[model samples]
Target: MIQGPCFQILLLLGVVAVAAADRRPSFSYSAPRASSEESGPAQYNFNWAVNDDSSENDFGHQETRDNDNTKGSYSVQLPDGRLQTVTYYVDGDSGYIADVKYVGEARYPDSDEVRSYTPPRRQYN
Candidate 1:
């Protein structure tokens, strides 16, 4: 039987041999390069809106982009009976800029019309 240092060396060699015998494949990834002719600024335009009187949901957004410049606007109906609109734009490195406007005056219910809330009691298990 192998003894002392020889036994330890043999055990280490066996472990190394088993590890080296593994044939699992290795993997790598690289992004595809864009062709020189295809290199150009991105441009697109899109708009969508949703208005439902039953659920009282009204909001929309539209944007147009040419190269590095972008322009867009979005509007929504406020619960206070006001139409809130925001117009914005972005030009190249210049950050986003916006202008907000409201179409109607806000209104609130009188003190007598407002109601107080009550919490229900919880039972212990």
Candidate 2:
């Protein structure tokens, strides 16, 4: 009949928010229990391919060949989260052309290590 102090601080924050929502803690939605010796084995093998006309301004290529090697890549997505690939490999019998690098934040020399296309360290003291 006579309260003030913002009505006793909003009635002591509504009785401490209804006694903290009656000691809040209630959840039930179970559906995760698997076994079979802990069902392991099966993380991820390997397989690659994604060159079907990438969109979003065209920049998303991916390839992976095997038979000694022959890879190709081209990724882009750097608004900050960091990622900007541009790989290239082809060492099928010393035809070692390389690219997938971050070898110290970028720096290409040693004539960029070519093979069948030349420059397999023709000279470099």
Candidate 3:
């Protein structure tokens, strides 16, 4: 059997050989170029709305985009009974522009009405 310094040298060389064998070679890759059809201008139009009377959720949004230009509008029913609407647009390199408008006057409950409120009772399971 091998002994002392010779045995240690052989073991270290064996370990180095195993480590070198486990190493993988590095690789390089280049992404493929996009074709003409895939690079074409973008165009889309979409609109959605939500009106839930029970939960008092009333809001909607609509937008149209062609190439670098886009136009849209969105509105929501405020808690104070006003309809808040915003119309906006973006043209090419120009920044976003918007106009806001409200349909109805805001109203708040009187002090007596707020004081008459009562919390609902909780039931044990």
Q: Which candidate is the best by lDDT?
A: 3
| TM-scores of the models, in the order given | 0.64, 0.24, 0.69
Off by over 4 Å in 3: 1-14, 17-37, 115-125
Best by TM-score: 3
- The residue-level lDDT of candidate 3 at 38 comes to 54
Which of candidates 1 and 3 reaches a greater TM-score?
3
Residue range 62-104, candidate 3, lDDT tens digits: 9999999999999999978899999999999899999999999
For all candidates, the clash counts are: 0, 0, 0
lDDT of each: 0.87, 0.56, 0.91
Pairs that collide in candidate 2 are none
- Return model 2's CA RMSD, one decimal: 16.4
Quick one: RMSD of model 1? 7.7
For residue 21, give model 2's deviation from the true position in Å.
Answer: 56
Instruction: Encode model 2's per-residue lDDT on 1-125: one tens digit a residue.
Output: 85879889989999999998899688999897776575443332244444322322224666666556667777654433344667777765777565653222433335444332342233335
Q: Identify the runs in model 1 with alpha carbons over 4 angstroms from their true place.
A: 2-39, 111-125
Scored by lDDT, model 1 comes in at 0.87
